[model samples]
Target chain A: MSQPDPLADFFAADAAPAVDRGFRMAVMEQVARRRLRVELALRSLATLLLFVGVALISPVLQRFAQLLGQDLSQVLLVMLAAGLVAYLGHFWLTRKPVLRLPHLRFF
Target chain B: MSTPPTDAALVAAARSGSDAAFARIVDRYQGPIRTFLRRLGPYTSDADDLAQETFLTGWTELRGLREPARLKSWLFSIAWRKAKGEARTMARNRQRDHDWQEIRPDCETPETERAIALHQALAQLPPDQRAAVSLCLGDGWTHADAAGVLDMPLGTVKSHVLRGRTRLVEILGVDS
Candidate 1:
């Protein structure tokens, strides 16, 4: 067994100091607010994407495609490459993420 | 009162959008998490706010946690980050206070007075060492667990605990 700290008894005695019920309620309220915000953001994004794809751009898209043929392909290739790199990087990061916390500095 | 559900069970329920399940998590962890934040006192001005932020992050990122069994360590990790993050916020919000260094714990008789003095001494350590001590000593976590929560190397955590523990013992002058 590892050598114990002399303060262990003190710590055990003090571990469960009183918690504020207000704090608990506040946390739950924030959780509800946050879930609502996320739902709203998703709905907004979905509407924006739907409008862009179906309502605003689809009618005039063929004219823009006609305007730049090979350049568009080059641009598409670059975009695809960037997306692939981002996906791979995210994959690499999520692997073995147990110890990867933000940098900590002591003053 | 009924025994609280295991963290893994609570986490699984919360991930399925059960607000009450997550609220139970908040109630279960609030004490130790707040105590850790308070004992790591220099880093956060409002332990309650930082603790709230930790649980809020937990609630929002429920699905991302791979192992719910490790939820205690994971939540502590979040609280550590929130504390560090709030330091930057506090630094921006107000003129930094340096008076904690000048605080001399009132030397008095009785075990309670000595305990208060010990806490004061603990608050006076460097923030990183205080964090290591708070997790390892105050909370009874292992050095490896402290290292994981604080994101320090295991060896570094051991040294921090050793130094912090020595300092606390010296300040308290407890017969060890």
Candidate 2:
């Protein structure tokens, strides 16, 4: 006897819809372009930040150290610590939320 | 003859910057993503955009996936979240707030009307419940796989599937 499958209609609706090849190509092209853009932007930003920090911030730090009669090395160390904190804060604020991925043994 | 590489192997290759491997992965999954999106909405452009966005996000984050073999579930999770976010924006613009917009079935033939009704009934379900039903009943995924994709507990996925099925029967005028 052929058994009745009641949920067959629901399953029938799950057929793979027609999607053109251009869709896949568009996705890959965008991903590649984004990877390059992000890499270049990050490189440019880091270079700019490093240049400004060293050229401008160092002289300002030297002035502050001399005026406060503090050791220049100690002032520089504090500035480095502040920079580290800023970098971390930026990362925490900008990081994309990660996906929740876990293996399913049942699959 | 060589056996096909597992998803994990392909993922590892893709992570190493192998575009070919990533392309293979895309070739394997594009249909499911597209079909899932199509079932979720009537607008072809919306489905197409979301499908592409889903893969782009997948490629961006594939390196960080905990389990490579879980690629299908992971991709579905990303798609699910993207679809939900887009739905929120659309609903906001329209000043309406239904999670799943019940699309009136528009098939021409009688044979297809029941199937379209099933799709509409499926869409009428709450988003999470519809996802559970789609992944489990529609796609024939195991409860565990559906749970993984939906990021819900196993029991919850099972419950959603059961309840979703009952609701579909009621909406489609089918006996339990």
Candidate 2 C-alpha lDDT tens digits along B1-176: 99978899999888877877887788788888877776665455687789889988898888679999989989998988888888776555442223233444454665456656666676678778878887877778999988877789999999998999899878877766
Regions of candidate 1 where Cα sits further than 4 Å from its true position = A1-6, A12-19, A52-107, B1-4, B42-45, B88-115
Q: Estimate, for each residue in A14-107, the C-alpha lDDT of model 2 and write its tens digit.
A: 5664455676688889888877777777777777988988897898877877787657668778999998788777768878333332321110
Write the residue-wise lDDT of candidate 1 on B124-152 in tens digits.
68779989998888877999999999999
Most accurate candidate by lDDT: 1
lDDT of 1: 0.77
Q: How much is the lDDT of residue A61 in candidate 1?
A: 78
* Model 2 spans > 4 angstroms off: A1-4, A18-20, A46-107, B90-115
lDDT of 1 at A60: 83
Clashing pairs in 1: none
Q: Report the alpha-carbon TM-score of model 2 versus the true structure.
A: 0.68
Q: Give the Cα error of residue B87 in candidate 2, in Å.
A: 3.7
Which lDDT values do the candidates have, in the order given? 0.77, 0.75
Residue A68, candidate 2: C-alpha displacement in angstroms: 37
DockQ of each: 0.19, 0.17
